[model samples]
Target: MRFLLVEDNAELADAVVQRLGLDGHAVDHAGTLAAAEDCLAVAEYDLILLDVMLPDGDGRDFLSRHRDHLETPVIVLTARSQISDRVGALDQGADDYITKPFDFSELEARCRAVLRRRGGAAKNEITLGEAVFDPMAGTLRHGAQVLDLRNRELRLLEVFARAQGQILSKGQLLDRLFSMDADVTENAIEVYVGRLRKKLDGVGVRIETVRGLGYRMDT
Candidate 1:
């Protein structure tokens, strides 16, 4: 999944980014509301991790301003443990609130739970022909054998699964598969698509190219 992290603390930002990246998620870090807004304009995120206090303004204010526009789930990370603070953040549109000095495992769990709620399932499995795509496990399996999918490949599959039977333009897939700072080319998407095609060949799944439009995943 792709995430936007609004945080001013460099250390905490770095730790969050590194940990989430290891879990096969693309993260973009913004130190202020301005930077976060910039990121939001360019990409659609699966989730957002927002700090309550930012360099530019309060995260709750930012949340309130954009809540109507953004349906993406947000998890607020703040040092204020007061009940009012938590209630205020939630009322301002935060999906979950996690106080500082919290464990990364707990953060991970919260993210998963929020995403699950958004997707409407805990497993959120997608059937690809005879194969099954599991977002939580980050794998594609056919009966007993698990297909060897790299992180990007698996992420691409997840994106397609979520929007199954719909055409996805190259730009949309690019934003979902790569981070804002990733030094990747448009043709790189074709490379990954080609690889996925070969692996899924003869399986119930098909990646169809719609002439000049883009690609669609069909089952």
Candidate 2:
């Protein structure tokens, strides 16, 4: 998942970013409301961890104004623990609220719960074609049959699956496949694609490559 963390506290932002990364998410940090608005205008995020006490303005106001247009889920993180505060945030369009000094585990669970709801699942699973992907466990299933995929293949399939029918460039695929510190070249993506394709064979969906463009799944 991709998350935009809007926090003014430098230390807290760094810690949250690291924790979210370890939990297999790509996070973008914005310390001020202006910066966050700029990020939102340009990039799409799966979730937003919005801090009410932003440097430039109150995050609640931002949510109230922008929530209608933003399909992404927002979880308000704040120091306030009052019942009114939680109710107010929800009224202003927050999906979930977490008080400060919270257990990271609980935050992670909240994230999964919110995302599960967003994906329209009773549990934490996403379906595409015949594949039912469990993002939490990183597993894919087709009814009773499960495909045993390697780490790289799984990540690649994940990108394609989430993209739905959108065409993806090799550059986009590379970004999803390797972290900044990982030693990998763009050409190596094709190797992973080849392996993923073989495993996906006869799965009722196929990954189609557009000669000059990139790859996308077709049913």
Candidate 3:
């Protein structure tokens, strides 16, 4: 899953980012509200770990501004453990709350649970045209033939299947498949798409390129 960690403390932010990365999550760190806002404007995150107090503004205010516009689940992380603060954040549309100095395991568990609930079991199997992909097993089947897909191919297909018909740009796909620090080129995305296209042909699923826009799955 992809996550946005909004925290002002550089040390804590680094720790969180490293730990989350170890847990197989793509994490982006934002030290201020402005950076967080910029990240939100461009990319979609599976979950957000928001610190209540940011350098420029309160995280609650940020949530108020974008909660309704984005479907991403947010978990507020704050030192303020008051009942009122928790209630306010929740009422403002936070999916979960974590107090500061908490265990990273608990936070990780909450993040996974929230994403699972949001994604649901139906998302485990994606069907596009004659192709059926089982994410848990990392298997792609096109009728009677099974296509051999690499790890990156599976991840790419999963992202497109999750978005389905939605247009996803190369940048967005790179961020979803790799970390913020990955040294991926624009051509890398094209190469992956070309590879996926060949495997998808066996199943009669077509991944259409949208000129200068991006790529989309066509059933």
Expressed as tens digits, the lDDT of each residue in 1-219 for candidate 1 is 899999999999999999988877889999999999999987889999999888789999999999998999999999998999999999999999999989999999899889988888856677878998887667888989888888878888888888889999887888887788989877888998999898888668999998888899999
Q: Is candidate 2 or candidate 3 better by TM-score?
A: 2
lDDT string for model 3 (110-150, tens) is 77567657887534577877878875456888778778987
TM-score for each candidate, following the candidate numbering: 0.93, 0.80, 0.69
lDDT of 3 at 175: 82
Clashing pairs for model 1 are: 129-204
TM-score of 1: 0.93
Look at candidate 1 and tell me the lDDT of residue 217. 94
Residue 5, candidate 3: Cα error in Å is: 1.3
lDDT of 2 by residue, 191-219 (tens): 88888888878777788889988888865
What's the best-to-worst order under TM-score?
Answer: 1, 2, 3
Candidate 3 accuracy as TM-score: 0.69
Which candidate leads the pack in lDDT? 1
Model 3, residue 62: displacement in angstroms? 1.9
Give the TM-score (vs. native) of candidate 2.
Answer: 0.80
